[model samples]
Target: MAVVNIRRDVEDQFYRYRMPLLQTKIEGRGNGIKTVVPNMSDIARALSRPPTYPTKFFGFELGAQTQVDDKNDRYIVNGAHQADALRKLLDDFITKFVLCGSCKNPETDLKIMKDGMIIRDCKACGKRSDVDMRHKLTTFITKNPPPKKAKGSKGAGKAAGQSVEADGEGVASDEEDDDEMAKQIAKEAKDTPIAKTGKDADENVEWSVDTSEAAVRERAAQALSGSMQASLVLTPGDDEEEGEDENSPYSIFNQWLLANRPGGDEGRDDLASAEIYKKAQELGIEKKYKAVQVLLQALLTENAPAEVPKYGAVIAKMTTSEKHQKAALGAIERLAGITYPSLVPNGVPKILMALYQLDVLEEEVVQTWGKHVSKKYVDKETSKKVRKAAAPFLTWLEEADDDDEEEDLDDL
Candidate 1:
């Protein structure tokens, strides 16, 4: 991965090192002649040149800024385009966040690549589009940041050891209880007090077990009588039922909606999935920013299939989700309200969350920025080559429309 810091490290340097260069050299800081120089070489030329549009210089043509009435128009149009691009690079590097390509959406699933080009698919549309490197230029300088790790710590290994200890305790259920039934039963009764009278602790009595030879024989005979002569009883394993809808009432809901998220649409009734609605609510989707987004996707409307992620109770059951049963009740709240009116607000948050999930500022990121990079950053020889690299991502957006079936994160 290319080394880059999305928030601080790169931003700190861009302001200190790169920005000063632009202020003192290109903008002139009130010291001298204003002109457009093509490349860094032409930057030193200092010859007077024409004024030009930002996008026009790179051959893409984004648009224009306020015009300087006093300066010569010719000087405004030349190498100024490249200088402006360099400035944008610094600004983007210093940015706190970057948005998705199509919608300029900051909250996304992740960056995706199609045809060997990196693009960001919208969390809302599921349609892939080119990444907008223009917003934070340093993001481009270090396109893929180095993976971060902590010093003197083994995160995964440490967690595994704790898990193994827990597993050992859990395995007790599988081990055979070899102790004689009478003695074993006596130990359980003596150790674990039972509430026979319900309220007063003093009302409970200590269990009395007789280990006398006659008593042991009596208990042994009863146990043997209860034992099967040729035992063949089968108990279903819970692990076998996992990921299967065979015995679960909510399993159908899991299959139809919650599990198809992230990869693609699963053709389910997302709105009707009452169980998932409850999951989002109990997880505090109505309160936290990111949780709100995750919840909204679970309750999406018309354009459903375009964006959804798989979800599992174990995975989704974070601190954000406490009221799983409550959230589920809310999912079908609206339908219930139509009949009883009280159920209206039960899952109304789910609908509102889904609504806020909509995004719109994305398409313009590429068309405007793509041109500037070519003229300013790309060498004349290579500018032609790099411009086409953004094509695959942009082309996909121009062709695809959203569908209606969506999935929740449980599927993953």
Candidate 2:
């Protein structure tokens, strides 16, 4: 079987992540037709995910029903999907679930928290990234979690950071071959007479570090500069001060919103927005485009469509250019598509309309945003869905522009 990089987008031939090429076979006739993935288990094992995940993802993407028989190792999706089509869809699945958000490495483990949130813990970068819970497959994964690995088991050992040697074909070499090779090497070592030179004797001796106070002080004096020594000395409450600065400005702002519960009380909205703006200024991130995204995400609630106008003053203050407006739109994409997906397919139009009415987003920017769907803030699928929800509002804007042109002609 031919293998490809798990992240097929990567053209590097030597990429460590590899999986078998997806193979799809059409079965049955007419309405009963189905696509069967014979080697899904093998591919899923390579990805460190359950075989049912990609299978279900295919169903969701293609608008088809899927069936998984774990005992028989059969995964099927209704409808005759071609191999290339399934392969393309599989890439999207890998992007949304397999790849680490921070490092883009596929070496991650999906962990479900007690709060019912799913996160991917990357083994390579040691970053924990939240999985977009809005995707339909997340509910299935939550209900039918991946099987836990048993302690000291071969699979567990492999999963727990053990490196397995693979052959040219990208398959793990047989354990029997390793055992035989080890035994042969041991026999040859025993048969040969041992020669111990001075260097060899030295290699056999263990090394230890000197830890006496005098030795430590001497080493510190030689290595540490005055500034370095002064920096190492911390006074009381220094840890708390350092911890506050350790968090990103956006993260700190989010925590502040949670603690203050802004936008909950009437007539205090402007005061809250002003305080938020002051906080942004104090953090020195007031001019950053990302601050707009964080602001919208932190301030907007599930009823974002209605609340957008309420916070219009703050939005106008933060978004001074097209780039900032785009960031604000990206925030809406994340909010509707990932954070509050339940409001999608209806809430987006109202939200966009509110922004347009408040002049927070320009007509040109809105038109450009509706025309292109990118995976900058959300997955491509979610991006497309969010844009689709905004289609009606976009159409209305276009029609209004055309009507204005006709009115100008009549005036002439």
Query: TM-scores of the models, in the given order?
Result: 0.20, 0.40
Would you give me the overall lDDT of model 1? 0.29
Identify the candidate with maximal TM-score. 2
Residues 211-296 of candidate 2: C-alpha lDDT, one tens digit per residue: 99998786545322321222122111100111212255656665555345443323244335677778877765576566677677
Which of the numbered candidates is closest to the native, going by highest lDDT?
2
User: Any runs in candidate 2 off by more than 4 Å, and if so which?
Assistant: 1-246, 262-271
Q: Write the per-residue lDDT of candidate 1 for residues 1-412, one digit (tens) a residue.
A: 1222222234554321121233212344343423333232122111111112121222223233322322332223222335556445433422322334543433232233434444543433234565444533223324443122221112111211123344344334322232353233333333332222211132454435798999978754542222111011111121111122222222232232334433225644333334555643443232322332223223332222123222222223421432322222222121222122221221232222222222211334433332332222123223222223223323333333221112333344
Give the Cα lDDT of each candidate. 0.29, 0.68
- Model 2: weakest 10-residue lDDT segment is 234-243
Number of backbone-clashing residue pairs for each candidate, in the order shown = 43, 0
